[model samples]
Target: MLSVNNIAKKLNLKVAAGNKGLEKQIKNIDISRPALEIAGYFSHYSSDRVQILGMTEISFFERMLVDEEREDRSKRLCRKETPCIIVTRDLHAPLELIEACNQNNIPLLLTETNTTNFFSQLSSYLEKELAPETNLHGVLVDVYGIGVMITGESGVGKSETALELVKNGHRLVADDNVEIKEVSNNVLMGSAPELIRNLLEIRGLGIINVMTLFGAGCILEEKRVMLNVNLELWDANKTYDRIGLEHKMVKILNSEVEQRTIPIRPGRSLAGIIEVAAMNYRLQHMGYDAALEFNGRLNNQIQKNGGLNNDF
Candidate 1:
């Protein structure tokens, strides 16, 4: 949730009038132009949004013949649910409109930015501030220019794998707890909380600061999560994907990220496997699939030989 004063200060808008209602809450991310509302049509006026009055809207109101009509329109736009009123291009608000805003106790803000540019700016700011967020238990690391999240049961060596990756020149985004926000459709941005930022925990070894142990280059403030790696204990009865053709996914927030489950066992390097997975994911995105290429080669050789040979 954002208040009218919060956005005004963020966008550096000037307070033209209605200073008492700066604390009004802005619930909707969408802004309204109020062009039709200015033309005496309030059938579908979005009162919950921040009303923007550009040159066109101001001109329409000024062109009205009767003063009562203008006052009525201004009064209707400043309903109880309205968050605030903003004038673009530093345009002047009508006298009746200013009086209406003061009467309704709605904030009146002004900006020198043009209509189109201000719309883009305000929309971008609101989208980020009001985006949906969730907390996740995992370690997010940047490997091979990809955001790889390691998740599994406690003590499954997630932190250990992340430490190894950091030693290999990778960047650590978050440790143990990752706060993810859905900035856009199907895009998740993960970052560590303030208290645990740049800190890693290893069982029996206690907690250590990653930035202090390694250089600042090994720490990332935030990263866009692209893949999820789940580490599980090795179970002989369970079957895992041997070939790379099988695709798995996990949902985090509103995005579905590619998932890979690696079985943990002695003498097996988890960090190396995760590095290869990140690299392979990048390759697949670049239109190169190793599994498909190998399958195609095997099929061609079998057809050329005309039959299977078991003379070994």
Candidate 2:
């Protein structure tokens, strides 16, 4: 839960203050409002917040708030509390105006790309992963202290597996959409999606409440993501990992996460496999590679057999 006002400070946006009376609420308020407010960079408390403008839009926005008759420099001076100003194309915003914004500490980001892509990405980041998360749905279970995310399309036994993991004494972090981010090079964290907070969907059962069913142990606010397991329909034809030799990665932002794809089929236990995978991944992270160990033993055997038996 991030307050929108706090976000404004983080983005370093300037608010034009058409009325100027609203400035006090903007300054003193300390509550998270993840929705979008004005356009520019996302200010703290606004939901889906990001500002976008064309030259014409800028002109109108500027003129709308200022007393302009001479030349309408209002366009250049309009934005008051935009977190950042992003200019597209080979454009100039006049020297004096640029200097004024710089003096006020507004970050003016320039990109060669259009406004569409910029807004798209910025919004996506703020919406999905950047915003603060509250864990109410699902559970954050620890498999030997490694955070494991168990999610599948619809049902496919996600929550049911989580129940087993918790019964096995693993802690639950979150269910449904796990908001993950690489905060640091060595760390990736997971939490719940805001809208569907603390809710898990079970096919043929509609939405069954996780927190209500399992109590406090069934809910987790957040956890560092050591690994991700995406459960998909089991494919008999596809070659599954029998040796854990190949490494898997899922890219989130600039960070690369170790990921495993587990096939789901009848008779195979999903939770058990995910638990094992999480343990194995943690071991690998700790420098214990099973494949490497196997290879070493194989090499030793070959050396003892006089180096590969050239004739055979």
Candidate 3:
């Protein structure tokens, strides 16, 4: 839960009144523009959001001063579990509104930004702060600007492969436990925990600091996860996708990411395979598919041969 005091500190909001209610918690990220509610239309009023009072709402309150029931309406609106009230454009809250807030212990905040700008900024901040996140056991590395997450069973040499990539000019994002957050609907961001950042745990060598050994360029604070590479032991019975015609995807935090499964065996250079995989993924993003091009050329050759024996 995000507290009103934390939001105030983050947004640089000034406490206009009701300082005692700073500890109020905000459950929802969406804010409210209480124009209709302030005008006595509370049928669909939302009390879970932070009420934003802009120029128009303040003007309405000013007009309400001529009415004999102004204080009653103001108190009715403030006497709910509304998170807080934010007055944009540095507009001073009317005495009635402030009194109502004090009476109900509802926090009132002031901001210098205009209504539209503040709403947009605060909504974005709240969305990010309240984003859904999950942790996965994997090794995340950034190779040629592509974020690749390596996953497999234990003893599959995931860390060793990541170390080799880091030695070859790639950057390590996280090792072992990777915290992934869905910042947007289709984007998943990967990062390491504070205690394990820039640290890699190898089988024989134990824990080693990648940043200290490989410099700052070999480590990244966070990266947008683009690909998932699962390394598994070589199985002769299971045929791998040599043609790369079939597309694979892995779901992470409700986002589907392109995935590749690489079979590991003795004498196989996993680091080289992963590096090429990253580059190939980037090429696919640029609308280049080598497998498709090869298949097309093969079909063209068969057509030219008049359906002759096309065995290659």
Best by lDDT: 1
What are the TM-scores, per candidate, against the unseen true structure? 0.90, 0.54, 0.90
lDDT of 2 by residue, 39-84 (tens): 2333343321233444554444354434332123323333455344
lDDT value, candidate 2, whole model? 0.56
Clashing pairs in 3: none
Q: Which of the predicted structures, 2 or 3, would earn the higher TM-score when compared with the native? A: 3
The 10-residue segment with the lowest total lDDT in model 2: 29-38
Candidate 2 lDDT score at position 27: 25
The Cα RMSD in angstroms, rounded to one decimal, for candidate 3 relative to the true structure is 2.3
Residue-level lDDT tens digits of model 3 in 1-312: 789999999999999888889999888878899888888788888888988989999988787556545676678778558889999999988888888889888999999999999999999888877789899999999998999999999999999999999999999999999999898987998999999999999998999999899899899999999999999999999999999888899998789999999999999999999999999989988999999999898889888987747376
Error of 2 at 101 (Å): 15
Task: Indicate the residue-level lDDT of 211 in model 1.
Answer: 96
- Where does model 3 exceed 4 Å of error? 67-70, 307-311
Candidate rank order under TM-score: 1, 3, 2
Candidates, ranked, lDDT? 1, 3, 2
Compute the lDDT for candidate 3: 0.90
